[model samples]
Target chain A: MNFVHTMETFVEGKKKILLILLAVFLIALPYMLNSQYLVTVAVKIGSYTLLALGLNVLTGYTGLVSLGHAGFVAIGAYTSSLCAVKLGMNFFASMILGMVVAGLAGVLLGLPTMRVTGTYLSIITLGFGEIIKMIAMNWSSVTNGTLGVKNIPRPSIFGYDLTIANNGLYYLMLVLVLITTLFCIAVVKSKTGRAFQAIRADELASTMMGINITSYKILSFVISACICALGGALYASLIGYIDPNTFNFDVSTLILSIVILGGMGTIRGMFVGAAILIAFPEVSRFLMEYRFVLYGVILVLMMRFRPQGIMGWKSTMPYRLSKNVKEQVEKMDKNAPLNLLNETKG
Target chain B: MAEKEVLLKVDNITKRFGGIVAVDHVSCTVRKGEVVSIIGPNGAGKTTVFNMLTGVYEVDEGEIIFNGNPIHNKDPKEIVAAGISRTFQNIRLFSDLRVIENVLIGAHIKTKYNFFQSVFRTKKFREEEDKKTAEAIQLLKSIGLDYRRDDYASNLPYGEQRKLEITRAIATGAQLILLDEPAAGMNPQESAELMEFINKLKDQGYTILMIEHDMSVVMNVSDRIYVIDHGKPIAEGLPEEIANNPKVIEAYLGGVQNDAEDQ
Candidate 1:
């Protein structure tokens, strides 16, 4: 235990250097590998990372376990693809539209379900995912029905087409992942984030503390849906085709598995989880269909033993104070009456 | 003392759970800058009264007036926004969060920044966040828990956890604080310290309404005392009066004459 503590501190001290090295490695990954297949795999990992991070906000931070996240993803992909193909909209505009539509759907789901919680809520979300798939299969005019939307043009900025071979999609995914990660961090560190966690901790106490639990819960849903939708928009363009089958119950479970396998409520855990899960099947192709059994066994063992995930351990370092707050605390400490401090200590 | 205004007036408030009357038409008034205690034996509906006052349980009948405003049946968040906050009997701290984070959560209403501002880290967001952080630290310092600000709330000793709960209530910017069983599990020495702490809060000009099982702490710190038995207010007076009241004794010790006759 003592040695582990020392090692944790040692890693903590070199955190900045490690982060920089990791950034360089990620940026140069495609060039170093010199393989289009590896680059596509990396893009897939990035896409899943975004989805997992979105679910983490709701499930991990806000304690709202959702099993219907793929519904939002389907909404985004279909909306974006339909707009681009039918209306000839720009990629960015359609992506934003997709996110907005999915967010509205989230509000629709969040409102009536505000009063329900626990297993009941998860069941509702699971049904919601199925409802969305049914709609996609039946809504022939707009969604193209079971035939699916095809010929999704590659997203391009300034006439530079983004394709897997050219590594444009990979870079785009990287940027989105970075932005999403930062957004999650900002929300987690703010007062809004605190209220979400407070509700997770104790709902009655959170209400007494003047947190509007209903509004916060709804806000959490909107944010999670938006991020997931953004990933779906990218996924449609990357694959150049999307169908209801692409976002079935299995996809939702896959996204949820990444969150659980990496660590719930953690940002970095999403990356590690997505990498391992997305790469595992490819590496174990020789095992064929039996690999899925191994996957199920691994998850069961994970639940039995390290349920918090590989990176879910709470930090041992002191809580980080922002710069201005630290300065103010020091100033207050200097001006505090010595006798008063001593009295409290006694 | 005669001119002291009523900070809270709970009048004829009754709560029913199915066939049971949890709190029956109970009423009490707390004056400004006073430490008022509600004392009762076990299952006397003390916590139910607290829950009703804090809006955790809606009153089946009657009114709760805070500073001349009718507040009963309002949402708990609105009640807190009207400047009332409370500690829980079981000490509900955000155990996974740091101590200061728990306090910051208490200040959630006062944070004032919108979701977009927080996401973008706007000037208003930064200013409000820094101000709240510094204020939370100062509150911890006042209670001598400044050094433990970075520690998870669950890591604190029981006594300190109790103190942190009160501090979190104050961080809500509440003028009237409700403490539910603030000294429930404290030892004699800890209760004595809590007595002093309640007195200190009184000196700081905050109105406190507390339900305490520790008679010593209640009797020592309360400016006035209200006693109830079986969900009804049986007596209310000065602590000395309550101590000497025959009805109060009967309620506590349970009919001495009846016991003698049975013997």
Candidate 2:
């Protein structure tokens, strides 16, 4: 009993130890170096990671080729920032509001697109994204007509203001990334997750088996939109500003490229894609103008040669055992001393 | 036997595809616990009748009522939901999915899960999913493919694929099953096995509707047979009666051939 307890504690400790180290390093980072430029770039990477993760859910799991993800992000940032600054709403409240609005927009896009697929679906979604970006740029009363939302307030926790400078915004972005990743992992293993995979595998056959493919695909779009919107709101808050030019069709294309690069329909691949693409631009500062061109080249090569991406679609994770094996493991764990730890964990 | 209760009624159903009338005023009834066959020459509208009954294509000018509810215009999924299921002529399994997953998908008609509950793996959802997989396995076991449950569906051989397709339809909790040429490509021995297997399926409380061109299979397993000629049911009754019907003989052997031979 004591041995099992020690093993459980050791396994649990190793996972959180890194998180604790990350938090401590962040708190001490600015004081040690006081590098404003590094902090700004790091925060930006975190924000973009959130956006890529959102796009991954669609392009990855459901095989939905979306070129309109950045549109949802733009809507989120503009709606939430305008609400907080113009309507006197709290930052968190407006974030939720932005998510709902973006999600509704996703449904509108997904509903008419229920029958469209492959190249046609992509063209339609791209048009939807472009139209939203145009609306954001031209709408004067709500979005300030190309000036973008400005002077958005920083979120305060327990009377402490976390600003974009000095890694305060960097930590906030990291926390949001963590939350979103966990939520996505949970969702991908659920029944709806299987449905998305089923639809991706085959739709006509899926319908014959009584799967409601339309509902599941729309749900994928909705969740993808919500994730993008949440990231957009957080990005606006962290940067303390927004602009139409910042999130456009190009951003949507870049995010989608990350999904393909990471291997669509995979959670771990999302992180790999996010890490590489988010850091790619800043890392290649010397050739900044050609970075996007290089990105396109690499993406095309990968898709042409290694279409499965880094992790591959089929999971090698021992934890992703079949349901029957999983049940057997749970049964054994229950009888063994591991039940106490298992019950509290998953 | 004819004593079994009638479960599905197809009345004067006519289906036209552009310029051609595929099924012209076809009428039939599927009795509870009986295996019925629709046998005819190619393009005789046998498969078309199966399609209409299973809600794949709508009847242009007739009604298909299942358990006394009009089901001709209903979506195939809704019809499956109403306790009916089917298999296609060319195997239409989800090729990339596992064998068990294919069967489990068919059981979706009886599965209970709201979207959010399934997405979050709530208690009820997990319970229902576990129950479904078990049922799927049991169905697979009956078809003798339980050991290969985790294998990809496309990897299964032609005969095994046909068996799996039937197993999947059985898992749908369907009282009536429509099979379009279930043994189209099987060898004689495999066809014999299919005939026995289908009879067993009927014994297990499934009302079977199938279209088969193989006369041996048609006569061996079918309790009743419907023969169509130029998109109309020219003869329908027991296998013996259908075989002896002058119209059925004319349709299969041709009256013109008989006249020319006599001259």
Candidate 3:
């Protein structure tokens, strides 16, 4: 027992050192890259990371697959921009408005939670995204139609304008992304987060455990949509333009792919996955046209080799029973453990 | 026993699943602190009755009264919140979660922290969390699973998984716990332990409703026994009286022959 305690502390110490090194790296990256294009790419990665983190809560933690997240993003971007342009709201208030609108859209879309899941749920979300896109395309009076909303003013904080080229914009996004990341981490460790995982683990069992299935399922969708909306509002501000085409099905698929590839239900994995996928096409322009093909191949290989993804708990940790229980498990027939685990997981 | 107050009253509740009656006019009463066993052959709809009691399946006829209040057509979660919880015939644990986490999920009803409080980790959240953890550990200790609290519930041996499911059910602060065929796959030794555990729960003042095929367990642990066949109660009496009842014997003999032919 004493030896195990010491070993745990050793591992804890190593993790702390590693975290400090990671913090140094993240703080230095933008300043180290002298090129403006590189910094912009970094900004895009930061925003996409935020987006993937949101999807992670729904898909990774709650096990609710959505194929229409871009609809929420579109809602966020347009709502924020329109609030500023038409309603004369400040940038900060517009962003909050965007989150609220997207959150409501999320709850609205979540109405099918009681009736569907897995592929059916995915299809429903996909249809919702396409419908949102059509509305954005046709609603010329408010959205300005397919021509897109142009010249979105940059966010101003305390009389300081965070323009496109300014480091202030990058720092602002970085801070918001960090906040979102921390907020998600907090959620995943809380009782509510455990309820989400419980529901994901088994909805029937969760309901039996006194978790309201409808409320928790909708809560997951609302939180995911709100986070995605925040990211969209930031993306619109960073790029200074918005279009219905920008928040398309392809973008939604990319975000979902990032979650799966990086490691579903893993915080650190989301950042790594988003950074790699977002930076890949930028560095290798020649392979840009075949990016979708590359993603497909990678996904197939991953499914074949590591269905749990890069940082999944099952991949990183060995299957283990308690020391006393291990003896009991060993005495059981060869296939009992696998069958029990599979039957319970199902 | 004569002075005991009735805690749960199942008033002729009937449940039909698409043209077939699963639980037909099943009426049973549980006193405040007693171990009641419901025994039947396969397809006797013992589990269906448990499902209705826990609100998993809505009663199609009549009403369920718990603590003198009508509880039919209520949601399953709400039923649990109202002091009833259950385990499945086949264990339905949150496989990926740690054992302690499973019990913590059961404690959801007692904890008062909301989403914002949890996210911000307010003082109330911390206090409730600490209190819940302590309570869960105590529950696990009673079931002899405290040492394995950190392990995934799926990793426990089959019998321990069954025990954990019981521990989780009790952790919900349930006054009435419905255990369905808890000894289905247990060895004789594990079944003995489960019998002891049921007795322990009764000693702790919990009202337990169990469906058991293990006659030794049912006869030794149950204060009262209700015998059913084909969704209807055939007999209800004390364990000694149930052991001598002619109709109960006929039902068992008929089931024993069916079991022999299937084998």
Candidate 4:
């Protein structure tokens, strides 16, 4: 057990250093690469990572298999775009509003549909994604219908416009991604994280242990929705356009695939999952029309062989590999009234 | 036994399975610091009564008051919070987890640390964790499995699993521990150990309510016995007194006593 702890921390240390190196490389990446096409793909992949990270929280950690993440993303994109286009709110603030709206939607959806488990849950989510897409397509009053919100303004931070091809947006996105990643890692390591796993393991047992299963499960959905929403907000801003097609069911499927393929319930796994899911299609663009086919084949192979996903929670941990460690993954549940009362007042 | 200072009181408890009554109009009391056993033949609703008392099933028509607080029909979490926890007939464990981890989870209700604190293991959290670990390890040692702390619970063979189940219930900080058919799968020697373990818990000030089919185990460990036939308790008294009761013999063997024992 002590060895396990040591290994986890060591791996985390290595990962921290690697992340630093990756950030540095990204900062210098556009300069080194002559192809503007490659730089553009890199940015898209970066944005997709956030979506995958968010979806991973729902699918992997909390074990609430959602296929409606794209719906949340669409909600985010429209909310932020509408805020910028009509409400005249600043870009970052609009994105925050977008996330809040998405989170609230998650809570509402989670309340009614949380009873859906396993395959039933998947079907419901699938239907939900379609419904959301239909609404986005038909709702002209708020969304401008299928014509979509075009001429979306660039996000200007401190009156500095985030112009395309390596600008302040790159650093902003990277910094936010890093922060969100850290937040995710923290959440997964906490007590609620354990309760989420315990519910996944056995809802009956978890409930018997005094864990408020419903709260934690809904919390997972809200967090996941917020993250996906943030991704959408950024995506629309970066592209400076929006359409019902921009938030398609394919994006949701892609996000789900990244979480599953990366390793369900792993914070670090999201990075790996997101990278593969986002980059795979763009990387295989040379195959032109067959790119999606190649992507499907890759996904099929991954599911068949490594169903646990690339960076599964255990594998991605800064620790030694143990057999079926998920079975022993701890249970952290309940509220601390003492801590709450002790907290300093504003 | 109004004057008996009841520690637990069940008033008109009934449990029905669709159309059949499993526990019918059953009400009983467990006095403080007493060792009580619910003994009956197979499917006599003894375990059902235990389940109801432990808050596993909602009572059809009764109130369960523990330490004078009404606890019937509450969620199992609330029941546990009210200081009642149990061991299953067949051990239900997070089998793949380490022995220490299993107990740690059982002790989850008492850990005051927040989620963030547990992850970062803030000094306060670490202190609390160390205290919990020490307490859990102490319990493991008490049950003679401290050395197996790191081993997977499922790897401990049959008897140890039973022991682990008891230790887990104990770890819950429960004042009242319900043991359902705890000695069902154990050999004579293991049963003897469990008998001693029961006494040890009693000595530590836990009130035990156990269900047992093994007559010798019940006779040896229980200070009192409640013998149920069908869904109703036909007799409740000291084990020796219940053993000699005419109704108990008929319930166990149907009318005539066997061989020379009858005379």
User: Which candidate wins on lDDT?
Assistant: 1
* Winning candidate number (DockQ): 1
Question: Residue by residue across B1-263, what tens digits does model 3's lDDT show?
Answer: 37699988888888898998878888999998899999988999999898888777878998989988888889998898888889989999998888888988887767778999888878887777766665566566656787787888888999899999988888777888899998998999999999988887787688999999999999999989998888888999999998877777777785554443442
- Strongest candidate by TM-score: 1
Writing each residue's lDDT as its tens digit, candidate 4 over B1-263 gives: 44446788888788999999998887778887788998888889987887776666889998899998999888778888777878878777767556776777777777678866865658876566665665566566656776677777778978888888777777777777888899887899988988887887776667889999888889888989988889987998999899898888888888676632473
Docking quality band of candidate 2, CAPRI definitions: incorrect
lDDT of model 2, residue A24: 88
TM-scores of the models, in the order given: 0.95, 0.84, 0.90, 0.83
Error of 1 at B128 (Å): 1.2
Instruction: List where candidate 4 sits over 4 angstroms from the true fold.
Output: A1-35, A113-116, A313-346, B1-5, B54-56, B95-104, B113-165, B183-196, B214-220, B241-256, B259-263
- Candidate 1: residue B55 Cα off by (Å): 1.3
Predicted candidate 2 versus true structure: per-residue lDDT over B91-209, tens digit per residue: 88877667877776676657777767865668887777666665555556556776677777878888889988887777777778889899999998989999988877766667888
Compute the TM-score of each model's chain A versus the native chain A and list the values. Answer: 0.94, 0.82, 0.85, 0.85
How well does candidate 1 score on lDDT at residue B96? 88
Predictions: Cα RMSD each: 3.4, 7.2, 7.0, 6.4
Which 10-residue window in model 1 chain A sums to the lowest lDDT?
A337-346
Task: Give lDDT per model, in order.
Answer: 0.88, 0.78, 0.84, 0.77
**Stretches > 4 Å off in candidate 1:** A1-8, A333-346, B257-263
Evaluated at residue A105, the lDDT of candidate 3 is: 95
lDDT of 4 at A118: 81
| Model 4 superposed RMSD (Cα) | 6.4
> Which lDDT tens digits does candidate 1 get at residues A1-346?
4664686799889999988999999899999989998898889889999999999999989998999999999999999999999999989999999999999998988885568988898998999899999999999988999999999998989888899888899999999999999999999999989988998898888989999888999999999999999999999998889989999999999999999999988887898999989999888889999999998898899888989987777777777778998887776763343123113221
The candidates, ranked best first by TM-score, are 1, 3, 2, 4
lDDT of 1 by residue, B1-263 (tens): 47699999999999999999989989999999899999999999999999888888989999999999999999888899888999999999998888999988988887778989989999998888887787778778876789898888989999989988988898888889999999988888878888888887787788999998888888899989999988999999999998878788888888785553342
Native-referenced Cα lDDT, model 2: 0.78
